[model samples]
Target: MASTETVKVKVEFGGGTELLLAPPQDKRHSLTLPRKDAAGTETNVTFLIEYIRKNLITEREELFVDGDSVRPGILVLINNSDWELEGEGDYVLQDGDEVVFISTLHGG
Candidate 1:
């Protein structure tokens, strides 16, 4: 039998994105997210983005979030591929999938 309940995923940070979080800059996270949201919608990268901001980021939320999606300069990679190729925020998560947030923004 198959299950749509897979929840374990690996989240990673890069290109100074880690610094946006609290001290220690752990750089990686192992999380067990809900397969379906409270509204019974399947969880996706958009959900994961909010989850990181709410659960992991302790400050500078503007640097990480722009509304419900990541800030413009942040690139989201799902399983090493660009998120645009994987349905952006609608990509359904699978067990053991790796998600990476890399900041390509810099101040002059």
Candidate 2:
């Protein structure tokens, strides 16, 4: 039988993205996700992004997610590598992986 272990990943927000979370200062999040969803598919970045938006974000959800993906100008990195190089939202999450979001947008 396959072990239905959870994957623990570290997620961080920066470059003004932290404002979406509570206190507007807390930026680091350690998350655990089931290895597979109810459909038996492995958890991916797309799922994690929504999970964070729904569960962790305290405000400004639009600043983080849009139309099933992260809004433009928000840079995502997986394990210190560019998410673009890691297949973007299709990249399957692994235990101990580090995901980071940095918003390039700034208030006027």
Q: What is the C-alpha local distance difference test score of each model?
A: 0.91, 0.89
- Backbone clashes, each candidate: 0, 0
Off by over 4 Å in 1: 1-6
Cα misplacement distance, residue 74 of candidate 2 (Å): 0.2
TM-score per prediction, in order, is 0.92, 0.91
Error of 1 at 21 (Å): 1.4
Q: Which candidate is the best by lDDT?
A: 1
Q: Candidate 2: TM-score?
A: 0.91
Point out the worst 10-residue segment of candidate 2 by lDDT.
1-10
Q: Model 2, 1-108: lDDT tens per residue?
A: 324578888999999888788774678988889898788889999999989888878887998899889999999999999999999999999888999999988889
